[model samples]
Target chain A: MSESPQLTYAEIDRTILDTLRPPTGGYWLAIMALIMGVLLGVACWVYQIFIGIGAGGQNIPVAWGTYLINFVFWVGIAHSGTLISAILHLMRAGWRNPIARAAETMTVFAVSIAGLFPFIHLGRVWLVYYMLPYPNQRYLWPNFQSPLVFDVVAISTYLIVSSLFWYTGLVPDLAAVRDKATGVRKKIFTILSLGWTGKHEQWRHYTRGYLFFAALATPLVISVHSVVSWDFALSVVPGWHSTIFAPYFVAGAIHSGLAMVLTLLIPLRKIFRYERIVTMKILEAVAKTIIFTGLIVGYAYGVEYFLAWYSHSAVEIEAFRWRALGDYSLEFWIMVVCNSLVPLLFFFKRVRTSIPWLLGISILINIGMWYERFVIIVGSVAHGFMPHAWGLYRPSGIEYGIMLGSFSLFFLFFLLFVKHLPSISMTEMKETLDLGESHGD
Target chain B: MATDISVIGLFPDEQKTAAVIEAMSGYPWLIDRVHSPFPSHKIFDALKLKKSPVGWFTLAGGILGFFTGFSLAIYTALEWKLIIWGKPIIAWIPFVIVGFEFTILFSVLGNVLGLLALGGLPDFKGLKQYDPRCSGGHFGIVATCTEEEQDQVIEFFQNQGGEVTIFE
Candidate 1:
């Protein structure tokens, strides 16, 4: 096999910084669309808050509707960053270098979007602080046993740690930007860079700090999603209650997450002409990871069914059967076809290498994962122990608008981020280039 | 600190930079620091620097975070004393999640603080001594030398294929 061509330091510097230049008209169009989405979502949310919880489609039994579905969806989308940045870094996967920054950026924005849902879901959004464990006048504290409480700890910790990890990696690169920039731009980067000089002492300590953070972040990713799964599993709902939920959720999170990385990066690479940095090789590697995660998720799906039958509980059996042939059976099969079947196409090199196929599969997986949550949340709740109390949840326009807005919000933050910061890590890319040249490959 | 005039040398090549660092070790001039576009194991080995101690700070933060997380859970459970079902007030099993999360939170806090303390960041004082080329593709060597030894250091840098400048 032929080795990749060498890139000079100047080439690396110029090409990476090319991303930070003034935005094109296309960029403005994308940003405007995202902004519109956010505004519409915001308007819907305001209407809901003012009018009350009844504006949502949720009713008896199916109390968790599109809001919880969107919440879990965004949270799952946030997983790839830690997976690519921390776990892949620990594993010393070199292809991760080009995509780590974008993935981590996604993690931060996705979590921020996900964080808002808890408040949006709360009919009393102003009283959200009651979840905090504090000594109050009423002697009230959030119950430790509540999975919702675990969510607070897990998600906030994920957000903080991921932000720090992203910022820490930015220091050296920010200094590089500072060196190259002028006027107000220079001042901003200077402050943001925290006076990094890339000195040996600084690099030494910074390396150790980065390693420690990555070490911590790896387990944090698993824990955050596992805790999210417990929000369902800990409940007595037949479909929701299962010991396998943790691993199952973690796998599904990563499955959708890897696809998202592809969805975002494939277009990103083409838009920025980063064909060299985010090479076909890198895309292929990511596609491979997608395949692996897909299988694990598929296995989890299979295991869930097998365990349901093995339990010999009529309710568990009915729950699984209902999911397959129930009212929302269309969504259940859509999820199966999207998540499990479409990903198998990646086994072929042609499919893995094709951008259109990658994008299509990624979009499908995203929908599949979203519907997977829908099936899990709405499917189980709609068919309860008492047939008389069972209910079906059809999402209202307000709920749909808010969900669309969440997507727009996520993209809005990312678009602004892409405009201001270097989308790729400058220092890491240079290091990779230098290593390549050092070996004279 | 003002009395000690500093000399800075810029190297376009990594091999020459390594040689310059090694040469400075034998002279009376105190090698202040080396700046490269990226971290180099070769440079660190040539300088014979000690391993950084930032990990210890992270360990301390992690331990502290664990206790803090436990305290928040256990202490609050004890205070609230709202018995849900027949479960114990201090649910150690479920509380482990809190402690685990806290351990990560504090570890990062500690890591960042440790980085700031050890790296001496947020101070732009060193920006004056910094050569922007060092961040581009060049490697920089900063040495502290007396006026008497300045000529020898400059000649050494020139001989090693480096561009020399005095740090103002």
Candidate 2:
């Protein structure tokens, strides 16, 4: 265990608040770029809403297009937060202390972004409430048999519990913020903190409550992606109809989630001067976990192909054959190289430790995961059982623009979060220092 | 009779704070509260408080959520009488998904509710004696005592080399 340097209470408080100070010009420049992208995305959505679903690239066979791909991508990205926060904490991993706050924040924002696509995909957004099982004048209820309905339930539940977990964890740190803040800032933090006074009576219950939330959230992390995968797996579609999808999707989710966390944290640590707290040792541990998950994803890929051949199902074989050699052949090879081959570099100590290497590999994983969804959703639907109905589907400019906007929105939220809240958990970091001192680290 | 006032002792070291709690365990002064930046097992053992009952709330809520989710799905299916994929109205297998989702939803609600109800949270009015430094890195002990014992309380904190603040 590489120890973090001992930090005093005042020093920890000061270091974290310094990140909240007014941004430099570069910060504003980045924010403006993100805002422009977001605004462009909104304009595209408005135009689509007015001109109808034709503005999107959704055709007969490929009704689920880039919006669906972005949905799964964002949902997949949301997994790492809970994995690092709830799962690692339950397993007694001490290194998660300084990073859990940011990871959980990522989960919240990614899910928010993911939740939007379904509404965007709904052509008549006003009738979107038809998806709910409320007692309505029409007396129609959503079919529980549909994985889409399960998705609604699962994603919404994940959002609520994840938000609760994130906010409850923030209470102590928010109290710290309230103490250091002045005037209007203090009032906002105080209300957000709900009068957390660090009294033992509240701490006793608070600790227990946090533990329960973690336990509750752990299964949620697993169930969410499983339900998402079922959205494809439940169908008789050749490429998607497989038993391996749930665990496969879960592993891939963690793989991409870890990559995204590293992608965000590397620059964040450098920019905010948090090298001491977010040490290279912690980064290495994360990289090591990524290598393991990446291998699982690679194994899943090989098994998927092998199973299709072994079963001697003509339809399945044709789907795999087309995926490797047909219309989307370039995307297929790129995903294989990015997801399966690139991560193997981490096996060497040098690549894992180098910030540039880690950043490059992370961005590759993000792109690869998005293509993974694109290939699974579009590639399968593009060439169906009826070859006569099969046709090519390409994303239009509006599709590309909206996708760009989604990314900008995600980063914009992260920028605001980094600027305002304590990105690292102040209370937990102080405890780590105390624990280090007692153990003579 | 509302004759009780309290004095809080703040210390830079956790061991010193834990020691004060141990020393006052048998005293008449109520040592119902101690403040620290993080949870301390030593102070917890010294105070001899019971395990928090918050988990019970989660358990209760999870059970209710499961039933609520199942009932809703089943009721909708039965009432609507709509069948897809030629399946039966009460498809327990598919309903399991809805049930599982609500289980998490209600359990989280229970957890937050238990936190607020049992921990007495959101009390902006009652925090007169809270020292901000306790959140920074200090440990504090708050003891409610009669006015007559106020001097002894202050003396006790002084004897322990603590920074004392008395709240009326």
Candidate 3:
């Protein structure tokens, strides 16, 4: 019998926009857990504000603790969105369009969450914007060449561009929403969409323009992460001074970013019943990307050991030794197992296809990536060449609280975003299904 | 209706779509309506340029993004001097990265914003025309004409083997 049920675009759009409507069981719990974590994290931040930076971990040598760790972790995690949307777009892979928005959202949220770290760690959130180069009465200015300063510019640029890319792709979809919206949603969509009429000529130029922007964004990801790597490598510190830092960081960023993409998407696909658009095929492809990058990351770790041993530099050798069996040795071991070993599980096709395992691995990888950064930052600096100067880094409650809150903030934004937009490209899906219709004599 | 009108139909095919476009070059008031099972990318060259401002947006956005990026980097580095590796306070070469990232990011954003603005998207008002089928698979064409010249246009469309609809 021919299929009696024909789902229209309206139904799809409604489902996408209505993701948050009085959930039944699982979704409600997830949302609740996210909200609770965020609230608790906020409370922790409050506790930290009263007590100061002492609540967490930060000492003489290891000045950057979990706060900086989270910052680097999240930034690395943000790169895949641009990689997927821009690189895949440039490469003309059709599977990218559906998943790109989700990845890009992850990037923006991760970066935004990461961006707040400096302030959270600063113990002075109000003066954050004072980091901007505003010509003031004091004639104060910042050094233009610091990698951290470069990171500020790079991360901000990445955020703005990525946001615009994701939102711009949403214009037509937003227009459709505006058309169906009855009240405030309609007004919001209308304004956000800017009155898209979907004329043929417009579509023609739109595709061209979108493609152009994607091409532009592809390289930005490479540069942004390299710059982030430079923040450490540019320094004269023993562990941070390796020339391999750029490639190593880039590979690690991609590794973490892929994990983040899977972590966010696997659950979403299951919950929203988006199996058709974000099919198992798409997940499998992404799994392959993860595996490839995982290998790269594992290799990068190997390279680090090789260079340190081969270079015969005392400081490098000492840094490596400390990382493996240092005061914070546990973090280093966790990073190796989580980042290197867990990813190896993906080599089996069965493991890659299993959503539960993917989620587990993704979560573990993120944790591991965070640990990796901590190991790199803290392991090297906390106990330097001078034994007497060795000091432990304990982030104040504020730093730790903000770090936890950052994830909550990201989830909160994502939850709100999913509720307003069509998570899947309805039009694209329809186009895919219409091949038979086109062949009718 | 034009008394000299002619009607012709062709099986929807790319070769036919191309033929119709090629044949239309003969008629002064040439109007050929070609139907396709799907939207054809080739039709664009047949009908191009709708005055889009996305280019300007991208250029401006990229500039803004780069400036802000470099500016932010410089600002932050100069703000305090708690040496990490005992390096100098004014770190310049390292800051080049931040500047580069901002430039790419802002420009890309501008392009997207410009595209949105140019496309006139997010229009809430349900349009009068454009059946949902238009978004589906139908390729529709509306060729306007006077009663006297309708016959010539129809003849040209017919010779090119196109679907011609006549209404008064």
Candidate 4:
């Protein structure tokens, strides 16, 4: 809603398309670094595979370690993308037009990265196909009642739906690029654009399809995360088995995701010169939403402890108590401070509007979120019922390498996305221009 | 197939283009297609097109997906006859999550299919008559007419301040 007034339709197309210009030497250097990180992760995984799963610190008690934590963290990071692209579109938030594309791209990449952690966690990654429901000579069928099976269905559906929704939005913009490009680029865009010509007939069905995808995606986003939460909620672990896990996880996911969007977008806005399009108004709006979600997350934390006390169950009480006061208490406190307390700073307009403060808080919140999952997964599993079986879990070097690799892969995909495609929606920007012009008259 | 001989009018402003489209309502069939860089309800209203039936595809896909999800769960459970937690062999409650995900996934696929099919997309021939400016800031109206009416259509577009081109 706060786009620059002087922007013409031509300027919008040109400026957005300009972002796709050839990457400079610095860009390649960053890409090279990310590629190295990715290879290090791969090398670690290969070593783990050859040396056995025990090489990465998964003992009897703390079987689910940093891999699960990273899985939940990355998935949580993906939530805000759908919330922005689909939910905001449904709400008709005009401010979403410029930021939607970036958010959606993040969703695609984050989800892709998130999907990999399960396989990385699966020491025998080659056996992943067995998780799929298929007929075989063994006549073994995946249990439909299992939450793990639900994760497979939910995550696969999410990845597919998010990709479709993202591509559907990109079609017209690809056409705009196609028209501007020539030779190889033109041919590539022509195919990617699916021969879009922006005809009224195409727009008619395209709008309807886009709306339907958004509608479908809105519920899918909620359901996917809910399913992910059930992976723990359905368990008998004292800290994990709670009805509040779904909404609590969903809120925490959005909170972290909003932080990540800020984390990525702030630097992107500066580097890409998208300050006019992704303005202070938009950033402030995101920060405000972060406050609301952060509060919900904070409340969930309190309620979790309250429930532990209210249930009068000794194990549940001990689980909550040990989480805050035990070996991993540092992580627990960091999660609390970052995920809940940090966003409270945004209540003041000054903190909310300050670029440095916003960026710093966003990054801190992401770290807090990662720790939140770590505390829940490892802490709960480590300090479960029966003291003799209890043990603390530390992420071995391989685990850290894989986690770093996932982040590198995520960023590498995003960097490639920025260089190849129009990072902003040129079509929507032009529509805003037309609407603004009409309102002006 | 031979392309239709049409008179194309390119307008710089969307408002003027919508006005020209509205003025051409009397000769509705003469308007082959109106193009713009973005979707304009104004142009859509001027064209007076019927509502898209893409929702039907989505609805059908949802129903199909729901059944497919339930059937897979039920049939596989029945086939295995293995009850771990003493729950029912056909537990409808847990299957709802699977059905819900599939419903959304298939519905999205259907919507995309309907869009491509109904919109006549992947239309390689579309570029033949398309002006690149339409993808930038221009609005284009392609109207087809007989040889006699071509001159009149060109004159009409010119009068409406549109830059006209004839595709023969």
Docking class of 1: high
Estimate, for each residue in A1-441, the C-alpha lDDT of model 2 and write its tens digit.
Answer: 446556677877888889988899999999999999999999999989999989998998999999999999999999999999999878867788878999999999999999999999997898998998888888898888789999999999999888889998899989988888899999999999999998888889988898888898999899999999999999999999999999999999999999999999999999999877787778888889989998999999999999999999998999999999999999998888899899999999999889999999999999999999999999999987998989889998999999999999999999999999999988777766766521123
lDDT by residue for model 4 (B83-110), tens: 6679689998998987888888888888
Worst 10 residues of 4 chain B by lDDT: B1-10
- Those runs of model 1 whose alpha carbons end farther than 4 Å from true positions after fitting are A1-4, A437-441, B1-3
Model 3 over residues A1-441: C-alpha lDDT tens digits? Answer: 112234444455555556635557765676888888898888876777777766666767777888788888888988998888789878766677568778888888888888877777777576777667776776666556656766777777777777777776776666666666679877787677665555554575587687778878888788778888888888878788888888889889988998888888987887787665566667777788888888888888888888889988887888788888877788888999999988889889999879888889999998999888988888878867887887777566566666767888898888767765766554544433323210110
Q: Which stretches of candidate 2 lie over 4 Å from their true place?
A: A1-4, A437-441, B1-3, B84-86
What is the lDDT for B104 in model 4?
86
**TM-score of every model versus the real structure:** 0.97, 0.97, 0.81, 0.97
Model 1 error, position A160 (Å): 0.5
lDDT of each: 0.88, 0.90, 0.70, 0.89
Which sequence of candidate numbers ranks them by DockQ, best first? 4, 1, 2, 3
Q: Give the fraction of reference interface contacts each candidate recovers.
A: 0.75, 0.79, 0.39, 0.83
Off by over 4 Å in 3: A1-29, A394-399, A427-441, B1-42, B45-95, B113-168
- Tens digits of per-residue lDDT, candidate 1, A1-441, equal 124667678877887888899999989999999999999999999999999988999988899999999889999999999999999889877778889999999999999889999898898899998998877898888887789999999999999998989999888888999999999999999999887888888888887788888899999999999999999999999899999999999999999889899989988888888877777778888888888989998888899999999999998998899899989999999999999989999999999889999899999999999999999999998997787887888999999999999999888888888878889887777776655522122
Please report the candidate that would top lDDT against the real structure.
2
Which pairs clash in model 2? none
Tens digit per residue, CA lDDT, model 2, B49-86: 78999999999999999999999999988878976689
Clashing residue pairs for model 1: none
